[model samples]
Target: MPHRKVGSSIHLSGQLPFKDGELLGQGVVGRDVELETAQELARHAALNCLAAAVQAVGDLDRVRIVQMLVFVASTPDFGEQSQVANAASELLIEVLGENGRHARTAIGVAGLPLNTPVEIQVICTAV
Candidate 1:
């Protein structure tokens, strides 16, 4: 429910790693969550972003990712934010091919909603 269209662009709100309303991973990375789990969660969140795009645009084939922002809930010493984000990027490319290549920013945050370790926000153009 966190997607909206503006002209030719679709903006998706931060998506957590939930499938069927089940949170896959929780807590801060390097504190209560492992790197591998965080990576998987990132992929899941990215999928959710794509799903929202599909909802707004009606087809995955017509959507091209323009930019993405990944948020990681991690401890002070955790510095692998980019690696965690890579998982999401990889999924996008695998799913959408070249159109999925996008400008991206990965950030570490103290916390996120529902204690989820990974969140992804996507902006796409309906082509």
Candidate 2:
């Protein structure tokens, strides 16, 4: 597969540490909310994360995705990892069009960096 460069390397920061629909930033005491499971990441809307990752690279036209590795933090019995992975897959497809369709692996792990529900890494052929 050929490598295509779509955007520059940029880091996106400032992710809230809770599920979607949960209060963010400062709140009254005893009102703190948290995500107890990985599935919550989707509830918080993973498409946003996916967009951020894609944006970090810049122009999507130059992107020819070769492969995608989607990691989901979940409980041992959680069988919905694939569903969560689909969130990223769908986002990539929407952003990159036909070129976004590529080899992919959706995996469940005991944990992830900062208890995040999902993390996506990609390999692409640069134009």
The sequence of per-residue lDDT tens digits that candidate 1 reaches over residues 1-127 is 6898888888999999999989998899999999999999999999999999989889999989999999999999999999999999999999999999999999999999999999999999988
Q: How many Å off is the CA of 23 in candidate 2?
A: 12
Model 1: what TM-score?
Answer: 0.97
Pairs in steric clash, model 1 = none
| Stretches of model 2 off by over 4 angstroms after superposition | 1-58
All candidates: CA RMSD in angstroms? 0.8, 7.9
For model 2, the local distance difference test gives: 0.52
**Model 2: per-residue Cα lDDT over 15-79, one tens digit each:** 33343554322221112212233334443333444444456555556656566666666666666
Model 1 residue 3 CA deviation in Å: 1.1
lDDT of 2 at 69: 64
- What TM-score should be assigned to candidate 2? 0.58
Give me the candidate number with maximum TM-score: 1
